[model samples]
Target: MAVDAARDGVRSRAPARERLRAGGRISRAARYLFFGAVLGYFCIPMAAVLIYSFATRWTANVLPDGYTLDWWQATVSNPRIQSAFSTSMALATLTAFIDIAVVVPAAYWSRVRNARIRHVIEVAAAVPFALPYVVIAFGLMQFSGVVAPQFQGTFVLLVAGHAAIAFPFVYWAVDGAMAAAGIERLSETAEACGASPMQIVRLVVIPNISSGLVTGGLLSFAASFGEFAMAQIIGRGLDTVPLWSAEMIRSYSDTAGSYNRLAVVTLLTFAVLFVLSAVVVYWNRGQTVRLLPGAGASDEGGRR
Candidate 1:
């Protein structure tokens, strides 16, 4: 009777275990399916654009009738496109640097010393998102007219606008980094060691928050590069990439090879962003090793 009862128990438990295994498999399969679908959704359009850029003619076909490098050549050689690309690059780079210089210290100070001022900074950062781009541009234009008339319709105004709008990105990134790094504790420790405020920030704070700085800088750069509405208003005829791309589409929509050129530009932009992302990832890995206690030592031991 005892043996029979034990067999019955074992039989019941086996089915339950089998069902749990099956459910786990189904869950994993579903997750993989969802991930693949999302990947495809984003990648397909870009793949099509890349193909079209090289296509000599692709009308109502599954693939191009032929392929050529004419569009790439034209886009590279065009002086107007070159000028626009350079302008966008310069503006984005400047905005990223300015945001880093301004936001890092402010975020560090807020995190370490006066938490009360953080709310005010948060409100200021959120202002760009709360208001429309058009309104912001108009307001800036009016303000610049009164305060610095010479800055009107110049790259200075564009950079200022870009920096203002991109502020939130840098601020949020640095704030999160500060929190994660336990900036208050770190600052206290450094001070206890007789380090000055500047030394603490330069030596302890910045090194720990390098990942956030890169991330924020990248976001700021991307935002400035892609911004259109404010650039259109404040730029006053400045030929950034967005403005030039708009003009290309509006004026040459029907012209032969115009779309191919646009596709080339799109791919180039994607490449630049991808390279930046790669850099960030590589930098973050090093930062991860440095930030975690004993991680670097463990890695070195494993290597040995």
Candidate 2:
């Protein structure tokens, strides 16, 4: 009688467990379906653009009649495009450098020295997001007009504007990195060891937060590279990539194969951003080793 009753209990629980397993499988399948749908939604358009860039003649057909490298070659070899690309690169590099120089020290000081000032710093950083790019661009234009009219439509103004807008990226990155590194505690320790503020920042803070610096700098570079409104208003004389692409779209609307060249430019921009992102990821992969306790000592011992 006892054995029979035990078998009955086991049979009852087995069906419940089976039902749960089936339900879990259904739920997982649903999640995968949703993910795939979302991925397809975003990826399909980009794939189309990529295909069109290589297509020699794509009409109303399902596929291109043929494929050729003419678009890529023509777009890359165009002197105007080359000039625009170089200008964008130079502006992006300058913006990234300026942001890194300003934000790293400001963030470090706010985190270690004066927590009270952080609110003010955060508000300043948030200004770019709160205001539209057009507003900022016009405001800078007006301000520059008043203080220095000679600076209007100059690369100097463009760099200043880019730096202003890209400031938040570097600030937030460095601030997060400093928090993660526990800069306050590190600073205190260094101070106890009779290290000066500059020494502490140079020796301890910067090294620990190098990942953040690179991430921030790359983000700033990407932002500056794609910026249009400020560049349009304040950099009228300059020919950046975005401006050139816009001109191709607007002025050459009737020109055959114009879109293919534009598509090539778009892909090139994506490639540059991808490379920068990969750099940041590669830089971050080393942070774990650097942050581990006694990592420096371990390295020295291993070397010896």
Backbone clashes for every candidate come to 0, 0
Off by over 4 Å in 1: 1-37, 281-304
Q: Rate the local accuracy (lDDT) of all candidates.
A: 0.80, 0.82
Could you tell me every candidate's TM-score relative to the true structure? 0.79, 0.82
**lDDT, model 2:** 0.82
lDDT string, candidate 1, 235-287, tens digits? 98799998877876776653477788888888887888788767766766645
Best by lDDT: 2
Q: Per-residue CA lDDT of candidate 2, range 16-51, in tens?
A: 345323334445566567669999999998898899
lDDT of 1 at 269: 79
Clashing pairs in 2: none
